[model samples]
Target: MEFTDHPTGKRLAALSLAALGVVFGDIGTSPLYALRECFHGEYGIAVTPENVLGVLSLIFWSLMLIVSFKYLTMVLRADHDGEGGVLALTTLVKPRKENMTRGAWFLVILGLFAACLLYGDGMITPAISVLSAVEGLGHITPLFKPYILHITLAILISLFLLQRHGTAKVGTLFGPVILIWMASLALIGLHQVVRTPSVLAAVLPWHGLHFLIANKLHGFVVLGAVFLVATGAEAIYADLGHFGRRPIRLTWFLVALPALLLNYFGQGAHLLSTPQDAFHPFYAIVPRWAIIPMVILATMATIVASQAVITGAFSLTSQAVQLGYLPRLRVTHTSASHKGQIYVAPVNWLLMVCTVGLVLGFRTSSRLAAAYGVAVTASMLVTATLFYIVMRKRWEWKLPVAAGLTALFFTVDFSFFAANMTKITHGAWFPLVIALLVLVVMLTWERGGEILAERARGLTKPLDEFLKGIADDPPKRVPGQAVFLTRSHNTVPVAMIQNLRHNKVLHSEVYFLNIRTEQIPRVPNFEKIELERFGSGIHRIIAHFGYMEEPTVALIFTLCRDKGVNVDMNTASFFLGREKLTIGTPPAMARWRSSLYLFLSRNGMDPAAFFDIPSEQVIEVGARLQI
Candidate 1:
């Protein structure tokens, strides 16, 4: 039943192969444009040996320190039950002392913003990655130039359309092909390196510093393009649960890191000898007869890369919804064995539209490159800030130790961020604007939900005490069981209270069901149900779920029987309370914000359907309130 059953070495090797297809796919394809961009992009500096060696040195060190150390060595170790991401990191942070400081709130907001920016990354990465890959066709024939846009569109559109079908199959098959891709990158770059031995000298740190000194501001600008090499580094940690630290670290250190540095230096060496090759150095390095074949391979690699990001976006959105930051969304499980493979309709279609729009608007990879690095550097910096908090507060590291590591991360992160900042007017504003809008929506919903909870709390009555009153009165008891869904355990459900008040009768047995999503990804099956009994046939049932899990009423019923609470689904009635919000009195939020919250509430998904309650067995009680 396990995914991997081989010996540790073989199993790790298989997982590492799969990791290349998913974790490193995005960064893997960077070779197609990263080095080329340094010398050919709009901000590209002169192709002198110093600049070439400097850029190569920067690219190499960036991968080791940023991707290897900061992420694999540091951030990957901070997983929340083996989950990693900006939102996941937020859960790890504890208050530095007590009363939430403005600083604590700032870290929280920064984490949210960092998470939001990734949607933009999701859209832009596919466009730029695919565009850059297909653009390689230009190297073969000028005839392909006019048709490049059309070709890119066709590939991207096809890729997005396939999301509904899921990528489990493609992911399975992509492992070897990606190995071929990496091997091809190394082989081709090695061919160039052998011809030009002088390029290896750039491996030293002095060349990078000397180049930066000679070029000054221009060198800083080139750092923005160099950043493309490590943009997919975040995937290393994001996918820690899938492959584990050993496989991912092994892949990075053994396969990916070496191939990337050699290829980059090879490109630098080639460019030093043949400066005219800057146009499309990645494809240019290939033999003339192999150019078309290499382009084909590169395009396929880009598709797999795009698949990883698209899949990541879906997973993140699901987590956000489960954690209560967003409204209920329709989530479809694509694989019976793999709960992680999910498809979201709204998110899928929205990303498609935005991704296609980016392709059409940006027109070329060179132009899209300007918009790419901004969000990446910003999110990385935010992660550093959060990671520092975890070290100091959670891990109990000394402030100086935490500060030293944070400073190292920040230096690299900020240098890239400052370099990319110059891109805002050109195109970097895109992700920032998207992140800001999403931040507003998230914050508004959070505050609005808090206000609603406050009002609901005021109306809550102690369940045991309320049941005692009913016991004294002895309201007429009916047959069959009533399951009332409540938001909290300590309070009586509004539906149960209303049913008693208006209907003047209670079911023979009443069950108060409260569902709570836990911070971890999944609750153990044995620990899913917790029950407490009270007088007058009143029972409280608490169901627990992980963020990655779906909680269904049917599952609850099935599991409850094993825990000594038996019920027949055919005869049971499910009760729900719908609150209609009206903006009046001391409004819970600003006028516009209140309206936004109301709009969201009215359109919010039906809890019955979301919980998989039988439609025929459901009864609703409605009440109006001013928030």
Candidate 2:
């Protein structure tokens, strides 16, 4: 792995600040209404001092355990290529099995399903965050109540409109605004805390435990509310590669976490001092003069939060393509300098449409919140399971220690998942719909690839026989040396053999390059391109790479030479078979689904970008196939 120093002298601060804006924005904004909705929602709570403080205590400690301990502190370090998230973490942790076991495959499918769920959460975060912030207007002035829908729609439209531009461009303003938002939360809540000093007792963390133990009947319900605070915690892991662990950890511990806890405590204190304000304590703590500005600032914070999630979805899709779970989608480099910063038009539009629907359908932030946490919780739970396997198999830790850690998380997660299940009837399907769609696409891609590979293997000739025939009748016209990238095992690619036979063109040395995905994500960099002599100046080059890493043709060719494979990059041309699929009867995919894959393939990432191949030297040979 290549590690570079901070981009500038101020890089530590700048990256930390940017991470605060991008990574924590979604989770950070949870305080806007996490508690209010907790008290007011189906949990059936009153504006009493104990209930508010108890719930506030739960919120604070939940963040400490789930976000701080379980994820930020521990899981962020389990990054794959500086990337963290369920999928990235999965790429890091997949264990070797002698054969595919039902349990192992079950876990794989579950984790993928969890990833699909995040797309749902991605759409919901913006909808709920924006709506909740806009809803704050009702507290400031009653006249704003009737126009809430219009105001929300307008704000949402503006938010979606701003997305064409990358977050890095407008990110300079995010930190200051989030800083102010957190400061105001602390200030407002602190004022109320001073008014009712006893409210500080809620910080003991035991009150949260007692709430669960004493109120066994409704503990699960309260957990549903508590989970909201940690809704976007997975983003921290998913976006880990965007900003390293040090800066993100520092930002959270030194800045974001403190602000959130203080404000949550402050809000609790205010509720105890004036029960009436519990109806809208976040705003009630503020002065009339400050309420409007607070609303505006909150709106900005929510928009930023939503933007981070949107960007995360884009990154996840890119990873999916490289890993072969999904067919390639057109990936436009959003920043020429950063390979990580990319834009997928289909994803952007899909998220935009779903978000707009959420804003319109829910119409209120509180309603959207019900559907939000399920996906995030499921995603975190999946990460925990994957990490547990890593600790045991890769890290070779004692099984008890890993199981204990995983159990703690699973207990909390399962409880929350069950709680959220109560909400399945109330518009949770929006996310489930997106998850199902992505699952189908991913599974179809895998199945289709398998069927196609089996078909190719059956149809292709043996390597020894084909090469023997080639030696007997050598072609006259030729390039100095040529390498053909192929999927056919052992034998030469059908196209290359066919081209040599018909065009009568042959190189002094013909290299067959076959790239394969291994079970693990990291192979020694030195072992990149393996070579074998097939005689007659013909060598087979099998390049090995972990999906987490990029495939650079020049670098691979260089590694081949270093490994004693006779190949020259400047004189060699790369031949990539472009398999054009025409839909036909295949048990792997239905007609409509096959159509979708074909359409997605046509619109997918350009081969040049996907393979990191230079366009001038890269040649695409069209191969027609029915899958």
Candidate 3:
């Protein structure tokens, strides 16, 4: 909606090209091997022209229905401010209650789990795409077979080496390369289609249905294949903030849609004409003279897809920090022009290492496909569930329609997940392992906070009463106006209450601020903030902000004036506690995980910037505690 920070212009054509480069990288490249897998599932090969065509048709319609109708057209409009990730969406849908209910919180947790699954997908995408491209070496010459690993390693290493520099610098090449890749797909597929016009049958959705209804075993594998085509569809919605809804919709309808269909149909035709050439259908479609160039182009496209996912992971992590699922880390804004463009060093290197490990371990796209769908599928299901809640609760859509749509999506997604479960022994474990580890860390941080909060309540004093007591004394030594930002709604922080009781120091006109996030797109005026007066100049200000809204200290402090709470911006000293969580008894996690949380928390983004509080005016008091 904002077209992000950097305005790229009103020329729809240029934006479409950029969208193709950024948004469609994952789904566009699925043509390379998506079809080959449809025929070669876990059981055997019984793919016919009708079935393949049916599968391709299913892929097209699935993208149209799930991605276009469900997400891009509908869900993208439901942005929490201009942000469009799963977390933002979840925040938009979280239900309000009198008490902090676990049921409402579970939705947030599921959305977080979906984000974790995406990290797994992020690791595997580059590996599988690059490996699949490089594996074309085997098709070229048997001698190339021996050198596949070296070539793949070189390609992957080069890709990782290029990460420090932003994609904007090299992005001109992505569009043209992907365009060429699409052309190659069409050219190869067209050759086979001319030989057997019957291959055109795959364009019909009913054919895919017949294949599914008629053949049970092959249909399950086809779900895995269909899953690939829609893998990056979620990016269209996630990146809606980047390119805007119109640009992405236009690109998907005009350029991306045609290119993908032509290439898929071409591949289907090629396979039908030369059924025995099924060993490597995509590469076989190209002439000998064009094969090397195809491989190079494929390599380039896969790298682009990988880079897009890599950057996406960085953005998601940054958002997670803002929303409090992650600990603060060092986030360096990479782009001078784009506030959304960020570079997280740890995320970058970790991704590069994990991707390289995945590429080497899987060794081929066919093998990597096993791991691909599970994470994406799980993510899709989670998003669908969240969206249903948004429709019913937020948008006030009819219960039946919302529930039916959600159930259909969940059924499809879970079935694919069940099918991929069989792939666990294969390289699929890589993503599952990554997802579980991330899930544990996320839940651990949250649960640990609850444990600490409970402990703090017992030990801490009533902050309002404490401040009132200090005000009654009228200490001449007390400083100017003060604003203390806190995470808890009740009484003094354990850190501060302990500090004052043992090491007594008090300030006049003390403002206790509690910044709490609500579970809706926007907070109503009634829910904007709550101020309850305490005796003396001391006051408790509980500000309820939607997760979508940027929490600016300047704005909130100004609003405090309207509510009859006074604070001098220049003289008001803001105090915030920086909790350094430690391992102790009544453990929320295992020792190793606690160690990981400590490590992650230490590296998290500084709290000063997170709250938009100026560093010079803010005093951070460190508190060591066990969660």
Among the numbered candidates, top lDDT falls to: 1
lDDT of 3 by residue, 1-627 (tens): 356444445666677777788888898888777777877644334656666677777776777777767777777777766667787777776665455478778887788888887788888888878888888878888999978878887877777666666665677677677777766776676666677677666656787688778778767766776677778977777887777777788778777777777777777777666667666678877888988888888888988888788888888876665556667656666566655556777777888888888777767778778677877877888888888888887889898988888887777678777766667776667776897887887777666556667765666677666666666765444767767776677687654564465557667567778887665434654567788777666678888875434566777777777777767777787787777677878566777767776777676666677667778898777677775
**Candidate 1 lDDT trough over 10 residues, lowest sum:** 1-10
Most accurate candidate by TM-score: 1
Model 3 residue runs over 4 Å out of place are 1-9, 40-44, 47-51, 97-102, 140-143, 187-195, 478-484, 489-626
lDDT of each: 0.85, 0.76, 0.73
Can you give the lDDT of residue 458 in candidate 3?
A: 66
Residue 236, candidate 3: how far off, in angstroms?
A: 2.0
Candidate 1 lDDT over residue span 498-602, tens digit each: 888899999888899999988677787789999888867789999999886789988987999987889788889999988888997767788888888788777
Give every collision pair in model 2: 84-237, 189-266, 329-605
Model 1 / residue 137 / CA error / Å: 1.4
Ranking by TM-score: 1, 2, 3
Q: Which residue segments of model 1 deviate by more than 4 Å?
A: 1-7, 94-101
Better of 2 and 3 by TM-score: 2
In model 3, what is the error at residue 344, expressed in angstroms?
A: 2.2
Winner on lDDT (2 vs 3): 2
Count backbone clashes in candidate 3. 9
